[model samples]
Target: MKKAFLASMLAAACVSATYAVAQTPVNTNNGAAAQGPQLSADEYTAYQAVITATDPAAKATAAEAFLTKFPQSSVKSTVLEQLVAGYAGSNNVPKTLESADKLLQVDPNNIRALALETSLLKAQGDSATDPAAKQSAYDKAADAASRGLKATKPAAVADADWAAIQKQVTPYFYSAIGIDALTKKDSAGAIAAYTSELKAVDVAATTQPGPVLQDTYFLGQAYYTSTPPDYLNCTYFATRTAIYAPEQFKSTFQPLATYCYKKFHGAEDGYDAVKAVAKDNLFPPADFATSVKPAPTPADQATTVFEADKKEDPTLTKTNIADREFVITNGTTEQAEAEFAPIKDKEVKLTGKVVSIADTTLTLAVSDDAKQANPLVADVSVTLTEAPKVAPVVGADVTVVGSMASYTQKPMMFTMTGGTIEGKAAAKAPAKAAPARRAPARKR
Candidate 1:
């Protein structure tokens, strides 16, 4: 993201003022009277021009000279604003922020000044590599945003102006807070920030549904992706979504669940499923919960997913490579083929569901234990030469024709050169269209 550039507010403001040093008022008095010379309109204009110059060093020198020459000029506010902009553009954030603070003392409701101040403080907070520094920066950014909002007259302004402020202030504030919480692993805090964003989205959705959806989608997706180990402190966000936007969740939260199941499973899947169901109406099909098993230990993860030797059962004999089940490891089928090449002519029994069948890759979920232990177990996604004639649903039992090799970085996924189905049966009964959920009525 591009850091905000200096806007033209200052340029517009500066055009109205001009002064010259030669116009300064000199006082020749007795030793008893030693007051400084008064800077007239021309002198003040000269001072302002130099301070507002584009050259960094010259601008700094001019700023100091202006304060010294006209310590109390009405042009001080404009001068300070310019100095802040010049210093900021020169990469002197501290000086820029300091000038902004001074400018704010004169014009507390100055939006441009407040913007520069907030951006500077946020940059500082973000740059602090240490925890304490980062937290402080996040807090300061939040405070600055709040102050800006209060100073702003949202009701008095036109809708477009009000919306501009909301876009600039609300989301950035929430994002700063949410990202800070994420860094600390404070799931609850992250949820709180995202919830604020959601509320803003809901309000904005009344007038602008598309933009609201786009923004809210990002916020919701962020919440879905932040699956902390054990779900440490995210129960509130899940519960709140259920209570507040059950309808919205019902429509939009399932895709997030699917993503979670694909990215992380096992204990993680439980949290993912709970959040999904709470916000939305969908549940993981019972069979899906039984598939993608997770291992209790690292060693179990290594051995359980890839068993070495096995004889095909006559009762459970599969038709071809595509009919048997298999999961993709980090490695490729060509490597697996080479490893299992000697046994290429040999037949092996594999059972799994076609997790996905795309034009290029075919992923399958194989082991029942893996499916159950980790509902989001990694599946075998192989490059296919041609699109498969069959399409696989999320939860379906199928058989495939393929051979396994010693697992590489990629799992030893079976490449479905071709195959036929051979499964006991699907655990799911069926899917039927259902009515939308509604909240109960309240008593008078």
Candidate 2:
């Protein structure tokens, strides 16, 4: 199966990478072709000569010149691939990534282009400060890894080389799998898959890493992104109930964190390297030193007495903020406003089914329909008091109540109110007070 898979991929790779080059043969008839933009025999020969040029500088210059002269060359993919490699080798990462992306744009499934793009994106991601952008880079790497796995040609690849490619690409596949598993809140499964990928990288790194090592490093990063810090010290790193124990992950994860920190912040305080991001993981300080603040004593406190007639009005729980809405109480649309208004400052329980989950918010539908109404017609969406360990699946039963509430447009949203996942129950109606009164009437 592996062989067959690789073979199919290789065929795809050829179509994407080399076929165009094969088609654009040099016209041998001297001036047979018009000199609009097409390559003549001499020009094609010159191009190939530059591709094979021993001097890196000369090759780059020649390739650039060829591209400038024949911007629409039929062998564009080939030219782009060579440029990517040449520029990358010259430490021109930006240009290398640009060329790699261009190659992908032309033939997205090209194996070499996919491989190059993955490496370049990973590199870029490592340097990015924006978490969103960094995550995007990792996503692109995962995509390239998928393409590389599918672009292999088993028939042409030597057995050893094929195995190596598998070792290299499997982490990408597993990294993606881990991310998906996390999305579903399958912590054990995600940790297992990510650990397997990390192990694979370790195995591959024993030799010259090539790409597998790079993939391993990025897999660790993705793991960090998907994993919640609170869970990491607890369930994630606990026992080997899933994949490896926390101890095992220490070698890769700690180093990865340190590397990421160092790369992002030069010699700054490692613990406080990153600026305060609301969503960033807050690992315990290594030395366990807590900064203590002075407390105000009763005698030192400033106090004021209000008039006997003074009154305190209740605060509004749900209000509009910017654009997005928030709900403090988790309940059906019909009950949300009332439920939140009375106990805006107090804790409450709301029940609903999952509708959708975005980065920071979860949309839930209250199953209010008895027979004729929509199941989620009165569903209410709420932002959680704490971010969920895993994204809840659509249609899953859930209950959320929290303290903060903000109103929104459309289906009207309330903001964050403190809450918990009370168990889901059927939206069954109360058993009709069964004409039981008829028996009482008889007694009367």
Q: For model 2, how does the per-residue alpha-carbon lDDT over 290-333 read when each residue is reduced to its tens digit?
A: 22122222112211001110122223333222101122122234
**Candidate 2 Cα errors over 4 Å, as ranges:** 1-39, 152-166, 169-444
- Residues 20-77 of candidate 1 have per-residue lDDT tens digits of 1111233333344535444465664666466547676577668767767767875566
**Location of the lowest summed lDDT over 10 successive residues in candidate 2:** 435-444
Candidate 1 segments exceeding 4 Å error: 1-39, 47-52, 153-166, 180-189, 195-259, 262-444
What TM-score against the true fold does each predicted structure earn?
Answer: 0.38, 0.39
Instruction: Tell me how far the alpha carbon of residue 322 in candidate 1 is from the true structure, in angstroms, after superposition.
Output: 33
The 0-to-1 C-alpha lDDT of every candidate, in the order given, reads: 0.47, 0.46
Residue 429, model 2: Cα distance from true site in angstroms: 51
